[model samples]
Every structure is written in structure tokens, then in C-alpha cells.
Target chain A: MWSATDPRFGFWLPLALLCLATGFWLTDRKDSRKRLASVTLFASLALIVFFGANTRGGDTSETALLAVLLHMLGPVALMAIGSLIATFSGPTPVGPLPRGLRPLGFSMAIGGLIWIGLMLIEEPPDAIANGIGETIWGAWVEVFLSILILVATLAGAFCIMMGDERHKEAFTLTILTISAGLMFFEIMHNGSDGLEATGWYQIHWQQMVFLIGGLLGIILAFIAFIALVYMAERRAPDPDVVAPLTEEEKSVVDAVLRLNLELEEVEE
Target chain B: MSEKKDAWWGPIALLMLLIAFSMNLFVWQLSGGVEFSSIIDRMVTGFSLAFGITSFALLFVSLGAVHKHMRWQEQILGLFGCAYLGIKCYGWVGNGFDSISEDAVILLAGLTAMLAAVGLVFGLLLALVTGREHIPDLLLEMDSTDGDVAVELED
Candidate 1:
């Protein structure tokens, strides 16, 4: 008897799916830059899936099944799209891979399945009780997913910094902002009794903090990724490495001529 | 070979740790919820006081390092110590001193102290590893080689 016309259920379900789909498409683009959109895209999909599943289906409905299906579709497709972009964009040199990061990614996928399974089995805690009866198992799923996203983002930032030092400052600052957002969210989620008691909870600016910061981070990371691909594609061949000045190099030589003359006079 | 073993701050951190440990113990000792407000106020003050003391010390260390008189190694040591103290203080304060179950506080305090202690131990290990690199030079170098003993800044 769940009405498609019910604003609470009807609105949130497709809105969440739209966010996920948008993330999926951006990550699916041919451009290497779009592939760098991976973390936000992945995180958004996971969150959307979770929110969608919880809302429309009360643990046992066909709606939960459909939400899981969409969840699987978005992330896996994006992952494939990212790999393809990385491969086809030429041999872009990346930084050292973070320890246990790929495994974390795989673990998050497994955790997602477990989360859906849990939702299917038990009803979510009521609004008033809030975190009542959130099992250690459920908490672990959330923690694992958060950590997975963080590590993956760090790995991506590392690759961008190695490929282009100029973008390093911007990329790192973006990373810091995203990390701060996650940290703030965690702190609030852990306990925000003061805010809740003071009645600021209903305003829910916390979600805005997560969304805005995450969007900005996604944009910066995308720019850095594309820059890496550009460097990789335009890199000189091995033969060109030892060869004498090309036209581009000769222009630099002419510019340095005055400086060389000045150095000669100083030596004399 | 210089004896620089004065952990005056250790007692301070330990005091905060004890407060965190004892608050819950004392709360439980008194049987539950006789009067909530006075208990809540005392708990709040105790937690805030711990946080303030530790953070104040950290601020002093940070400020001291801006001047030339403080050695770089001392600054590093101070930072690690400050982090330890800060963790204990924040843990006590943030957990809402007396609101939760005493059993929960016990576990929380134990975890907080264990993590801080581990960090402290790791810092000691780091000191041992890098001590070899600096000790020889430090032993050979006289304090007066720079010829002027500068007083710490008045800030």
C-alpha cells in the first residue's frame, strides 16, 4: 500500500537515483578527467542506494531489490569506465599505490551487499530512537565504506600530485576539504547531542556541508586527472629524449641568449 | 648522556586520565540518578577543566617554539606530548562526563589511554631510532658554541 504519490517516499527514491545516475555518467565519460570523478561518484552511489533502499522498501519489499540492482549497476559500470579511461588515455605515470587500497574498494562492494542484506532482514531503527539497535555488523559496514572511499580518494590524489606538481597544492587542499567534511560528518554522527538538544538538528546544515564540499572536491580531482592524461599523451618518445633541440627547445635557447651573454661578461 | 627525563606533563596527563577514570567510578559508586543537574554540572566542569589545562600547555609549547632558544628536538617532543594530553582531555570532555553508563566510560577511557600510550611508545621508539643520528653530534657540540644564551621570547 505504499503510494507512489507519497512525497516522502516518492520524492527521495528517484532523487537519490538521479544523483547516482549523474555520478555514474560523469565517471563513464571518455575523458580521463571524468574518470577522476570516481570517488564522489562511487560514494554518492553507495549513499543513494542506502537511502533509497531504506525509504521505499521497509526491509522486505520489492523496492529494496530494485534499489540494490541500481546500486550494482552504477558503481560497477563506473569502475569499468574509470579503468578503461586510465588504460586508453596512454601510460600516465601515477604515484605509488596506497597500501591495501584496492582491497578496501573490493571490501566496500562486499559491505554494500551485506548492508542490503541487513536491510532486507530487519527494520531500520525508528526516527525517535535514532541509532537504537544498529548492530556492530551494520556499523562495520558504514565504517568500512567510509574508510574505503577515503583511501581511494587519497590514492587518486597521490597519482595526480606525482603526475603534475603544479596542481599539487590545489589537489591537496581539495583533499583536505573533503576529509574535513567526512570528519565533521563522523563527529556529528557519533554524537551531536548539544545541537540536537538545542534544536539545530532539524535545520540539518550538516548534509549541506557534505554535499557542497564533496562536489567541489570532485571537480578539482577531475581537473588533476585530465592533466595527468594530457601529460601522458603529449610526452616525447624515447628517441626524442636524447636528440638535440627541437623547434620548441630552440625558442627557449634564443630567449636564454641574452642571459648567456651576461654570464660570459661576468666571467671575463 | 644528558638526563632530560622530567615528564612534568606526564603527571598532568595522568591527572586528566584519572579524572576520566574516576568520574565514572564515582558516579557508579553513588547509585543512579539521585539528582541529575548537580551531577551533570560537576561532570561538565571536570571534563572542561581537563581539556583546558592540556590545551593551555600545548599552546605554550607551540608559542615557545617560535623563538630561537628552544631546540627543534624539544619542540617535536612537546608536540607529541601535547597530542597525548589533548586526546585524554578531549575524550573526557566530549563523552559528556557523567551522562553515559559508567561501564561505557570505563571502556572509553581505557581505549583513549591505550591509544595515547601507544602513540607515546611509538614516539619513544622514534626517538631511539633517530637518537643515534643526533646524539653523537649533540654530545660533541657545546651549548655555548653559539656564544650567546638567548632568553625565551616574552610572548
Candidate 2:
């Protein structure tokens, strides 16, 4: 029977797909095929992040799901933002052939490292009630770490947007989507209370609606990304094969070629 | 090219900044025990800003690609279709989020609907993203380029 503690699709599905998506991505060689695999991996990771947020962590006062989710926000936000920043502002490719893949690899490596480190910390999962009961200092530690990660992530995004043109649109979009999802989550979480006070409470449905909506937003964004990549890859060969006169066509073709080059640049 | 290469990170960094900003904002609320409405307002604004920008990015990327492929008119049509779907999905999600009242049936129904929607969206997006290239006939056309359009089949 379904209950409040019922496992979320957010948690299970993303984890399961993570394996499949990564496998496919790693196995695929064709540019188009690789793109599809990468997108799948990206989408799965995002979903994992979303669902992870709802699970409890090894601390107390909130559901373990929620705490774990919160815990994840720290590392993910930090790395994502850091990676983005590195994308635009970091040291120029020093010893690399294709520069783009290096940053991606570096970021992935860092993420894996952090995950391992956190596990080694052996932090026990804590419920909300436990968190509330903990001493002020303990709470402060959590808050401080969380803040540090948040700051790093935001800074990464800001630097990237302000400095580079290629990824500005992508960074802007990701930031916006995350912000929107947060707002929806917070609003519905609180609005139910207000409605209850007014004697017209309808909370359960609200959660469902908001979560579903957020998920859809995530899916659409993923689709848009895939389309962008496909278009870029597909348009790559035209400039090499066909001669064009119009400056506009040249520029468009150049853009496509650049993207193709970037894709090819990824090391592994 | 250096600048272009570096530019992609801007959004990701900004996302981190926002997360920090929002967390601090929330911490301020929790620490001070501020009124719920204030927190809600902040949260809403944050969500709007984040999601709105994301939507814009999605639109830009999608449109850019579509314009490259189909005519401008077709690109616009495609954009419109995506937007329509997004809006419709938003409404459905909003309804589910808001439907969690004391009514057991409504709650149950809402949960089911939300789960289904999330799964559908997640699964479809995954499949589409991983299989997007296969969706286009462009590559198939290009296969001949290797054998060369110069190869006149004696058929």
C-alpha cells in the first residue's frame, strides 16, 4: 500500500537509468549516437538530483530523503557551477587536443572524488527530528558546508555567463530551470498550510501537480538540448562539402562545424 | 575560439551562485523564523527566474537547431509545438501539486497522475535524447558521401 514513506519514482528510476545511460553513452562511437547517449546520461543525472533531494540524509529533523537531497545539492551545485566556470574562464587548454572534453572529464573526476570522500566520512543518515534535536553547533556545520557549496556553484555560473559566449545560453537555461523547480517546490510546500488556515485545504494534489510539472520541465529541457546537439552535428559536413557564397550561410556553417569539432574533441 | 570555449560554463556557474543565494536566503528565514509568506514569496520569485531562464535557453537551442534544419517558418512551428506541450504539462503538474488535500481519493489520484507524468517525461526525454540522431534522415543521406555522390550506380 502507498504511504508517505513510499519510495519515489524519482529515486529508483534515475539510478536504474544512470547505469543504462552511461553504458550506452560509453559504448556509442558515432557522433549522433554519442550525443543521444550523453543526453540520456545528463537527463538521468538531473532526475537523480531532483529525486535525491526528497530522500533523507544521515542527519535528523527532516525526512532522511529530504536531508539526503539537501546534502546532494551542495556537491552537485558546486561541481556543476565550477565546471561551467571552468568551461569559460579556466586556463586555456595547455596540453590537450580537444579542450572541451578535458573540462568535462575533469569535472566528472572531481565529482567522483567528492562522492568517495563523503562516503568515507561515514555520516549516518539523520531524520528531521534528529536534526532539530542536534546542538546548534552541529546544525551550523551543516549550514556552513551547504553555504560553501552553494556559493561556489553560483560563482561558477556567474563567471561563465559574464565571460563566455558559447555556453552562456546553456548556463542561463539550466540556472533558470533549477530556480523554477525550487520555487514550485517551496510554494506548494507552504501554500498548503495557508489554505488549511483558510479552511480550504487541498495539499496532496498540489504536491503531485507541482512535482509532475517540474518533471515535465526537466524532460522538455533535455529534449531541447538533444535537438541542439543533433542540429549542430548534422550541419557540420555541409561547409566541408559544399561551397557557399552568402556570408550568413558561411557563419551558420562555421558555427555548425565548430560544434562538430567540439564533439570530436572529447577524449573518451 | 578561446572565449567561446570558456563561455559554456557561465550558465553552470550562475546556477551554483543561485543555489548559494537561495540557500542563504532560506537560512536567513529559518534562523530568524520569518513569516511563511515572506519565504514563499522569495521561493516563488527564485523558481520563476530559474525556470524562466531555463525555458528561454531550451527555446533558443531548439530554435537554433530547427532553423538550421527546416525553414524559418517550420522552426517557428516547431517552437510553438514545444511551447504548447510545455504549458500543458505545467498545468497538469500544477494541478497535481495542488490536489493534495484531506480527500484520500484526490490525493491518491494526484499521486498516481504525478508519478505517471514524471515517469513518462523522464523516460521519453531519455529515449529521445539518446536516440535523437536516429530521428533525422540527414545521416542516412550522408552515408552516400562516404561512398561518394560521385559513385554513379550503374542501375
Model 1, runs deviating above 4 Å: A1-34, A37-53, A56-268, B1-8, B30-155
DockQ of 2: 0.04
Candidate 2 local distance difference test against the native: 0.40
Query: Ten consecutive residues with minimal summed lDDT in candidate 1 chain B?
Result: B99-108
- DockQ of each candidate relative to the true complex: 0.01, 0.04
**Candidate 2: stretches off by over 4 Å:** A1-26, A29-63, A66-206, A239-268, B1-155
lDDT (tens digit, per residue) of candidate 2 on B98-117: 32111122222223333322
Name the top lDDT candidate. Answer: 2
Query: In model 2 chain B, which range of ten residues has the least summed lDDT?
Result: B99-108
Error of 1 at A89 (Å): 45
Give the root-mean-square deviation of each candidate in angstroms.
Answer: 25.9, 23.7
Question: What do the candidate models score in CA lDDT, each in turn?
Answer: 0.36, 0.40
Candidate 2 chain A weakest ten by summed lDDT:
A193-202
Task: Give the chain B TM-score for each candidate.
Answer: 0.26, 0.28
**Highest DockQ, which number?**
2
For residues A44-100, could you state the per-residue lDDT of candidate 2 as single tens digits?
677655554544443222234335334444544544444443443333444323435
Model 1 residue B116 lDDT score: 29
